[model samples]
Target: MQFVCPQCHISYPATSQRLRCAECGGPLDVADRKRFDPAAINTEDHSLWRYRAMLSLPDGARVVSMGEGMTPLVEAGFAGQPIHFKLEYISPSGSFKDRGTTVLTTALKAWGVTRAADDSSGNAGASFAAYCARAGLAAEVFTPASASPAKLAQIAVFGARLNKVEGAREKATEALEAAAGGGLVYASHAWSPLTLEGTKTIAYEIWEQLGRGVPTCYVCPIGQGSLLLGAYRGFKDLLAAGLIAKLPRIIGVQSIACMPIVEALRQGLDRAAPVEKKLSVAEGISLARPIRDREILRAIRESGGDALAVSDDETLAAQRDLAQIGLYVEPTSAVVGAALKRLKVDGVTVAALTGSGLKSPPALR
Candidate 1:
């Protein structure tokens, strides 16, 4: 498989070690979907690796996994309509980001990477740290100072070198990028196609759980949009394989405090302009400028999806409601819960509960 720029249509080999497009500086995506083999899926494995045939890792590569995937698909209700929920927070790292971290770290192991760096508000860093620890590689995770204490604690507990950036969330990313200059492979969940390789398995699992059928809508919260893009890519592969008749409409939910993607979609722009981000309880989805903004917007538009933003109050209320149902999720994950109320759902809908509520503030819990 090769990485291709969606905008420039330029291609590069998978082993090129380049993060972005060398020509146009755009985000790179894995366009070679010929490897996806639904018939060859490893049915015995209950984790994301069950779909290993579709990943970009080299043959016989060591997979760094913690059984992350195969989350439960349970029936639930939202706004007086029945819907399905992907309980992704039950992952090893307590968040859906583990799905991507496993694949990315496995690829790193294949490439003989000794050290890696990444930036996250919380969950991605913790997931990366845990996988890198399992892979016996050194990890340096940069996180914002305002990151949840639970997530920061998880990162440190995984024995990663934690660098806390004092300013905005973007500062952590900047710090990680600068550290990557020191020969550390940037195993970024947001920027790496390898990460998407893991996350896309969620779609495959959802397809199987639905009896190889496509849902009417797929909803989730967006920060850097890794999961959203992964879902889009996976469903695209399923459609190509004739396993599904159509793709689900991708609905992205963002906090009103940081709605760059929503604003970009609303304005019909190819890329998201920077927004003055406000402090939000749903800190996980408070990214100001997503690196994959164009790709994210394209996926939503292509799938006939729309983006929406909700207030902190709405997200908090969603969290409380979910807790009452015994499904404790972080406020960021609750963004999807809030969104389900506003969307006009005509058929089966599925929303991803991205992170566990244990990652939230103690007071909120």
Candidate 2:
């Protein structure tokens, strides 16, 4: 299997030291056009690493696991409303990002990489740091200055070098670029196919829980559009493998305050354009120009999915609603819950609870 660029169509070696396309520098995915196993189902392993054979990592690989898979897809009742929340915070990093870290960091460790660097709002940084620590590798995190302190602290606790950048995430990302001088791999959660590979496990679990069938609709917040992209590819794989008959219509929710991809989608643009970010509690879904923007939009459109934006206030209200139902999630996950009210669907729906609210801003409580 190999991954091709959504923008350039140039293929990159799957499971190689190389990630992005060298020609156009675009996002990559598995090359083979194969799908999931419909007839044969396996649920022996718990973490996202359970799909090891399909993954690019070496055989008998020593993976950095934190029991990050098989999270409960609990049905939630809030304000006389029916909703389902995927408790991703139950992962090792207190966020859904552990799925990706489990794959990326383990691959790095196996390849003899000693140090790494990445940028994130919170959950991803925490996930990377925890897994890298477990793998005995050094890590550095460059994050927006406005990012939640508690989230940054998680990376620090693991002894990862923490560099806070002022201004918007664009500025923070630039800071990481300026400071990076080779030797340290840019282990960006947004750029790591392994991380996305890890994320696909969520789809696998969801399909299994649904009696090995795809759901009617899948909703989640998109920052760099990792979760949505992962599920899209996973479900498509299942469809290709003849395990599932069809793919679920995906809905990617984002914060209106910093909605670049949403704006692009609304404008019918495939690539993500740069934008000035506005403050919001859902710090997780904040991205200006995601590398995989084109693929993200295509996934949504191909499945008749839509990308929508929600206000921070609406997100907080959704959070309160979920908390009432005993599902505590960060503002980003709440954003998904809020968008669900806006989507048109009439079947079993799943909204991935991307992170625990406890790790976000304290005012959320």
Candidate 3:
């Protein structure tokens, strides 16, 4: 497998430390042309690494894992329609980001890279710090000052240098970008191809848990489009492997306060345009400008899907409603539930509950 520019199609060695295409400055993808076989599935290992055959790790590479994946897919009723919920908040760091963190950190270890820096709202920072600690790699996580206190505490507890950037999440990302040029490896979950490779396991697990059948729709909250891109790639892989007939309609949820992808889709734009973001309780998905905006918009359009935005009030109501049903999730994850209130699907419909309520904003608590 090699890193291939999604635009220019230029290939780079898998071990290359570069994040984007040098030739076109476009996003790079781990271009693994190898076809996956269902018969090669590791039945004994239930973790995300069980899909090792399809992952893009080098031979004899040491894995940095935390038994992530195999999250529960529970059936429930939402908006008077039968829907499913993938409980991703139960992971090691209380978010789905762990799946990517494990693979990205492990890949960094294999490349002999030690110090790493990343920018995140909250969940990604904590997840990265935890995995870096497990991998014996030094980490510095930059997060917005408005991030949840619990998340900041979690990052610090994991022994990572926590730098709180004032203003919006973009400020933190900019701070990390500048620091990364000064010898620190940028382990951006949004920019790293390896991170998406790890998140693709979510699609595989969902397929297996549903008796190898694809759902009618997959609803996910989009911040930097990490999970959205991962789901798209995973379902595409399944289609390529002849394991599924078609990709499920992927609905991307976002905060109305900051809905770049939603606006782009609604306006029929090929790329996302910057928006004026406001303070939102769903801080996890409050990205004014997503770096992979084009890729995310493309994935939604190709899957015959659409994007939705909900108010903070609706997200809070959905979070409480989910809690009433014994599924307590953070308000950011609750945006999917908020979106579900408007969706009327027939067949199986699944939405990812990405973060635990413990990491939610103080108002929700």
Candidate 4:
């Protein structure tokens, strides 16, 4: 597959290390969309690799796996209604970011990359570090100095060098980009199209768990919009294969403190504009400007979905509510619960719990 810019439509070889379009600076996507063939599934493989036929990895690429994906879809009551919760936090790295990290790491290994760098608040960094360690590659993670101590420790424990940027979360990304310019592979979960190749497996699993049927709606928290966009792409593949009757409505949740995508949708804009960043309990989804904002908005709109923002109070209350139901998740994941309450969606619905409560600071838990 080749890397294609959605905006300028510039094509680059799939082996190109550039993360964004050189002409328009837009995020890249895998140009050749693979058709999903259920017959091609490796049923014996319980991990995300079960859908390897649909993934966009190069031929003969060695997979870097840690038993990621195939998370449980637990049915529970929420707001007096039955809801299916996709427990993505039960991953090897304690967050859903592992899905993306695995594919990215595998590609890096195939490309003969020995060192990689990435920036994340916590979950992505930890996931990348763990996968890099598994792949025997040197890894460096740039994180905000104010990130959760537990997550910072997790990254460092994986033997990846940690660079704590002193300012905002974006500063951490800036630091990683500077290093990437110096020849380090930027295994960016947010910007790299290969990451989405891994993440799209979530939809495939969800489809399988639902008896090969699609849900009426799917909900998830959006930071860089990987999970949501990936799910959208996966379901679209199913639609193209005539496996599902139609695409599911995908609702993206964001913290009110930093809701660029929500605001962009509310204003009917094609792209998200920068918003004032504020401290939020759901630090994972507190991005002021998502790199894939336009693609995210397009996915939501195409799927007949809507974007919603919830307050920290609502998110915390939802966290407690989820814990009471035996589903403990981070504040970022709880935003879906809050949004669900507001939506009161009918028919079959699934909410993706992206991160584990164990990853949160003790006080938040």
TM-score result, candidate 2? 0.92
- Per-residue alpha-carbon lDDT of candidate 2 for residues 138-203, written as tens digits (9 for 90 to 100): 899988877887888888999899988888777766787677656787777777677778788788
Model 1, 1-365: lDDT tens per residue?
57888778998877626789999887788776555677889999988888877777755688888888999999977678788999999999999999988888888888778988899999999998999899999999999998998999999999999999999988998887777755688877787878778888888999999998879999999998989988998899888887787889999999999999999988889999999999998899898888888888999999999999999999989888877777899999999889987877988899999999998854943
User: By the TM-score metric, which is better: model 3 or model 4?
Assistant: 4
lDDT of 1: 0.87
Cα lDDT tens digits, model 3, 10-29, are 98887636788999777788
Best by TM-score: 4
Those runs of model 4 whose alpha carbons end farther than 4 Å from true positions after fitting are 181-183
lDDT of 1 at 331: 92
Residue 235 C-alpha lDDT in model 2: 87
lDDT of 4 at 159: 100
Q: Put down candidate 4 lDDT per residue, 1-365, tens digits, no spaces.
A: 58999889889987737788989888899888689999999999999999988888876899999999999999988998889999999999999999999999998888888989999999999999999999999999999999988899999999999999999999998887777856588878898999888889999999999999989999999999999988998998899999999999999999989999999999999999999989999999889899989889999999999989999999989988889989888889999989988888789999999999988954844
Which one wins by lDDT: 3 or 4? Answer: 4
Model 3 is weakest, by summed lDDT over 10 consecutive residues, at 32-41
Better of 1 and 3 by lDDT: 3
> Would you list the C-alpha lDDT of every candidate in the order shown?
0.87, 0.78, 0.89, 0.91
Estimate the TM-score of every prediction.
0.96, 0.92, 0.96, 0.98
Worst 10 residues of 4 by lDDT: 356-365
**Where's the lowest-lDDT run of ten residues in candidate 2?**
33-42
Number of clashes in every candidate structure? 0, 10, 0, 0
